[model samples]
Target: MTRRALGRRYLSAWIGFSAGGRFSQALATVILMFAFGQPTVQALVGSAGTWAVLVTLVVLGGLSLLGQRYRIEWHGVLPLSLLAFVGYCALSVLWSEYSWVALREFAATLGFIGLGLYLALGRDLVQVIRASGDAFRILLVVALGLEVLSGLVLDVPIPGFGIRGDIAYGGPIQGIGGTRNFMGFVAAMALVTFVVEFLTRSVTAWRAVASTALAVIALMLVQSPITGLAMIALAVTALALWALRHAQPRTRPVVNGVLGVFVMVVAVVAVLAHSRILAEIGAAGGSASRLALWSQLRVLIEQHPVQGWGWVGTWPSEPVVPFDVVLAPSGLPFTSALNAFVDAWLQIGLAGMLILLGTAVLAFARAWVTATTFPGVAYVWPAAVLVLLAVTSTAESYLLHGAGLMVFTAVLVIAARRRSWRGRLPR
Candidate 1:
């Protein structure tokens, strides 16, 4: 190969390594190291990691475009997904409460979309997910060790370590997103990745250690309603998938049934343990506030129902439409709409809704096509994870914000682009 070709190959390998879900998970833990105590600071600084990753993506994309020669010849669903996103952006501009803020947020979203497409076209998706899984497991070990030391130093209880909080410190090496929701998401990914690794390979002491640590983190997330519930749901789905792959000839149905039962039992237990999450929703006083906000969106939709709100607002206090005070906790200057679906409605109206819906269809399409074709690939599970994030988004706003949205958008791109690279790329 020419020098240029050699350079491209090396870059491709680097991107592939970074693309893994496990690597992302480790990166997430490092970001979490920064986020733990100061929620606000965590939100701000945590984004730097994603921003850095995006920069890397852009650089690789530029390289690919410049005689880099990367191509993906799959069905055209990716194009449809891209078109829906663009349509949402246009409609958002037409119907937004704050066009400028909406535009900025939409721009970031577009950036993620670009990165996803780049990954799909430029490198091996399976390798990315596998590497990510490995990195994630390693990081879980570190997180567990940190939890133990921190608990001991601080005299606060740490679950697996059987120690109290003393050693925990906030910085880039530790915390990523401060709240339980974000942490829960990370823990869920870690646990699922560990399980997948175990099924695919052999169980080692490290896997056991990581699994225990992840469980502790998961328990702590019971309070984060969106994260906790979404993860539990996703985990159950993953277990089912695992069983489908590894089930005995006669026991396949039995395993599937048992997985279903497990989901039900855990769900009931989660609800019982974290009734506060439900209480908070109930306290929101029903749909009155949401309806009031929807009224403004309704008008925009009538004008262009196909593309309702058109990227309109991101400022905390700004409302895309008029909403009752009931929409948020009283006296707080501002809070997110706390619903990605509502945010989509307010931003693009009906057109935006179509785009949102289309994205979901595209997600399932990608996952199903991939799972059917690749069967048992490590990256397939992230598809269910994308669904989890989407569902929880209806109840929480973090996934659209600084750290949460950025990280998720990247992974979504990775999952969406998954195809068999076995023969195409030299493994």
Candidate 2:
């Protein structure tokens, strides 16, 4: 074949991959789990291996975008609010205390945004959701397989990774993921995806059941409190959305209004009675620790409330805010504010926090509206996922990195799509 023909073939493959083809989906599954999975693959092959995987995916994604003649449509194809938030993050590099770190994180953020945009623009919502589900299925299987090997056959913790077989106390199984909480988070997401797939009849009943069973089993073994709460929140939100979807059109506005009011009231009450509530839930110690950290973080925020210290993708190795002075006595490994909102404030200041909050509020609102009125079962997944993210973000800084950032981008893309396309979706 001619060089041009070869380029065309390569482009076709990249596009297929972006559209959630089997090969691309498999690669994505690994990429998503790489960092969390104790850096298992990274330990063997070294950082070079991880870099190679990332570079390959990035190149394929870039080729896919070029093949589509993709254009960045900030207002139409993408949400302006999200763009504003990301732009602020990039711009913060100027005022950031750690400019180099900020720059690196900014680049990574852009890369994730690009990947999300490629998936959203190149394929319909159904295809993206299905592709994500497939990726999750693979991750779930791999994680569980590793856990079985570690707990049964090998009968020892994975070498070099420090993954232990804590079969007692519901396991605390790290699986391939580095931390039990991270594994639980992945499993929770997989459970949500599989549930959606089954509800929509997108997969064979047996396959759906098996996938969900694996996810649930993984989640149980990991025993992450945050994921457990998130699972419940997701279930409640999904059921409510289903009910709203079936309600009369005219009643939706009224029902939504009532629900909004109810949620606000509950939020206010929770804030007022937070201490007692935390005590009741047996989370007083954890909540107190978070409060102490928040207090210290607040002092730092006030120092530069408008501009912030800088956006480090992950927590800095060194003390950026005298956290060591305040939190050292507690002996808590408090790397983050334990909340995405607070973390955003600490990293980019109050203005950045508002932008992040605004982006989330608008995206969730749009997703909720579309899911209820879009006339298809598949529309519900984004809304459900958003709810789960929101719940998780309260206690974990899941945003601004890896799977969290991708999900955030996907929601924005789904929310921005034209309503006219709803009719084109499969029933």
Candidate 3:
């Protein structure tokens, strides 16, 4: 064989070996754990560690994509709405008031998106879900362990993991997720994953039960009202999915219509009784802080209503125009608007906000439809996760960055693979 041919053969063999099932699973797990533990990393090793982790994932995922080049059918693989939103975010750099910040954030956004795409395209849906399940279990345990050592054993907050030594107080514990709300969010995702794994018989019954118990404990310890509400939404979605999956095909249409109407009515009722509900649930104080922050954001959003300040994924430490206009509870610049939609408007503008809404809504619709029609339990993962994300996003900007953004992109791709129309055309 020619020298070039010999080199190509060796490279192909290496790719095949590296992208094999076991290696892919490990990659997915590491990526997920790294994404979820961003705050812990930032606390321990600072920005250098964060950048190193990102670079490693980018390199690993990029090579995996190259190795699986032919396996991922590239016909309408990505949803158009998603592309429009991300593209707009990138385009914002041109008119961004802080061009440097915008460029840096745009790069970070692509890095995470690439990691997500690798998981969705390089690994099957079941494999990705399983990896997520495994990663969450490990992280949740670590969170609890750290909390125990900090809150109970040492009687002091662990600065690195952000455990506020509140576990002894029955928590509001941060865990490896960096905050109570984040920890709760991770637990909620873990619960969904565990349920699906059980339904699919992918894990033993005892194992599923144990994982579910761990997630529930973490949720309780975190004491986050945002997660409380999300769990409620998750339960409702689970019930709806179960009903639809069990219903006869002929009657499914009627059932779906009725469920849709029911959901609308419930939403209206919830909005109307929000005040009473908040007071009863002890979320009024948190809600008030959020409202004040949003009011501040609204003023900022008004300045450049057409195309707001710009895209900076995380707020800058130094006081800047929009990013530092408001302060976090810690007296530093607030990182997010605490609501994904409002944050989108603040960073990208009304047009970008609308595209983002379209992307999320379209993704949910596709996932919901697939869950209803597909026989496998795996189809429900995307829909259940989207519901959880939507609910939590009402109070926290979890959907915008870190693990949330990565998972969002992955689910979007998985749902689009089967539901998007562009895939029907010749590639």
Using TM-score, give the best candidate's number.
3
Candidate 1, superposed: residue stretches over 4 Å from native: 1-57, 64-68, 71-77, 94-97, 134-175, 202-212, 215-222, 242-306, 312-327, 333-335, 398-427
Q: Provide the global lDDT of candidate 1 against the true structure.
A: 0.52
Cα displacement (angstroms), candidate 2, residue 152, comes to: 3.6
Model 2 lDDT per residue over 1-427, tens place:
9999999898777665554555445444444454334256656676567656656666666665555454533335667788898888888889876677678768767766766776676556776767777777877777777777777777788766547867544587886666776677788888888888898888999999999898888988886767877887776787689779989998999989988897789789979998897777556876777787888888888888888877765575555543444464556556567889988998888999999999898888888988989888888888888888898888878776666887788777878675323435454
Candidate 3 yields a Cα-based lDDT of 0.87
Poorest 10 consecutive residues of model 3 by lDDT? 313-322
Per-model TM-score, in order, reads: 0.62, 0.86, 0.96
- Model 3: CA > 4 A from native: 1-13, 328-331
Winner by TM-score between candidate 2 and candidate 1:
2
Clashes in predicted model 1: 42
What is the lDDT of every predicted structure here? Answer: 0.52, 0.74, 0.87
Candidate 2 pairs with clashing backbones: 36-178, 37-176, 37-177
